[model samples]
Target: MQILANIIPYFISQVENFSRRERISFAYLSIENVLGFSKSDCILKNDFKINKKDIKSLINIVNQLKKNVPIQYIFEETIFYNLKFKLNKSTLIPRNETEELVKWVLQYKFNSLFDIGTGSGCIPISIAKNSNSIISALDISLDALEIAKINAMYHNVKVDFICDDIFSYIPKRKYDIIISNPPYVLKSEKVFMSKHVLDHEPHSALFVDDSNPIIFYERIIKLSSDYLNDNGMLFFEINEKYSGDIIKILSKYNFVDIELKKDINDRDRMIKAVMK
Candidate 1:
């Protein structure tokens, strides 16, 4: 049997290539994942005994962390907007900025909504759990849509999961809101990203061509004209570097009431506009 207190230090020592803060955070999360122990429980129950099997699991988690695999993927699940969702390499892990975009989406009421490039169905499922909107989500990858469908079922939320590339998709009906946290990272921006993200997360869900970094945004904006109801709202989780360019695209498409909002990090990471 291993005491919780002793395990933490050992876990920390085994994990590398991360900052001091990250090591501590991962250690706590590893404990929680392996033992169902909270952060406070680690200290309060420092004498908590871990059996051999759990100890092995914790060690495996630490080894994965050392290799820069995200903790969420290790656990195969993550909590977003207070809802638990399954995850895998098939989907990009939901981001805080995307949560902010969902918050902006939840601020208004709409009947029918559609999400473009829904990876794990985090956005629409969270909104569906909170609102009565009829939500439909689209993704090109069947693997991603499979995970998304499972998440919707687990959450007991109804979302029409469509497996289709957004560029070729023709909306069968208009929606009161169309939202997306689509691929906005340019291929050139790969150097600035973390090793864990570049190495683990799905590339097609993350990157756009440097030649047309705003391709997803532009296609969604153009489609919004046909897919959105009169005066319908449109929302996007944007790349901070190209917020101005996205606004210009929206304007060129004749969208009005364009609003750009920052994430918790104060980066220009979200944009909302109205269909005129």
Candidate 2:
């Protein structure tokens, strides 16, 4: 147990590629999960003794980290838009860009909303927390939908979760807004991604064949005209390299008021359009 005190420095040294802030954040998060301690505990009691069982668990996590597994997946949970969600290999972990998309949707006038590819249900649940609109979330992976359902329960929000591919699922009712953070990464780009993401995350939730990077967008836009009310909005978290291509697709569909947004990192990460 006393050995755990040495683990921090060791972890920081091993994670040299990470910024100091990232190291501290990951260390604190991993420790909290294993030791049930808070950030203050870590700060005020740097030499606090860890139990043997906790040490073993922490060591396992460290080994996983060494293999470039994402820390969020190591812990199996993460906070998105101030809400906690359970995550696993079955779904893509929620990202800040998705949170921004949710914020954009919450600001719009919508009587009912649908989240396409709502892995882990973070986006729709966060929106439901702030707005009174009826929400439904759809995902093709049943395993992902199970995690989403658990997240909805954990957040105490009522959302209709459908386990079906967004491209095939036709909504019986019209929605004023539809949001999605679809799989848009090109397979050719996978070689350039961080090992932490490419190795640990599910491929189905991340990649599209380079030959058809906009496949999901084309299908969604085609079906959206039927499900979206006149003047309804469509929001997407898009691949930055293909933003111009996405705009062309929306234009082809006759969607108006098209806009592209940047994330905090200044990457073109989101797009919005209105059904004309």
Off by over 4 Å in 2: 1-5, 16-20
Candidates' lDDT values, in order?
A: 0.90, 0.86
Candidate 2: pairs in clash: none
Q: Report the lDDT tens digits of candidate 2 across residue range 145-177.
A: 999999889888999999887766788798999
> lDDT score, residue 64, model 1?
91
TM-score of 1: 0.96
Q: What is the lDDT for 73 in model 2?
A: 90
Instruction: Return the TM-score for each candidate structure.
Output: 0.96, 0.94
**Model 1 clashes, total count:** 0
Model 1 gets an lDDT of: 0.90
Expressed as tens digits, the lDDT of each residue in 167-245 for candidate 1 is 8999989999999999888889899999999999999999999999889998999999888999999999888889889
**Which candidate comes out best when scored by lDDT?**
1
Please give the lDDT score at residue 59 for candidate 1.
Answer: 81
Q: For model 1, give the 10-residue run with minimal summed lDDT.
A: 7-16
Model 2 lDDT, full chain set: 0.86
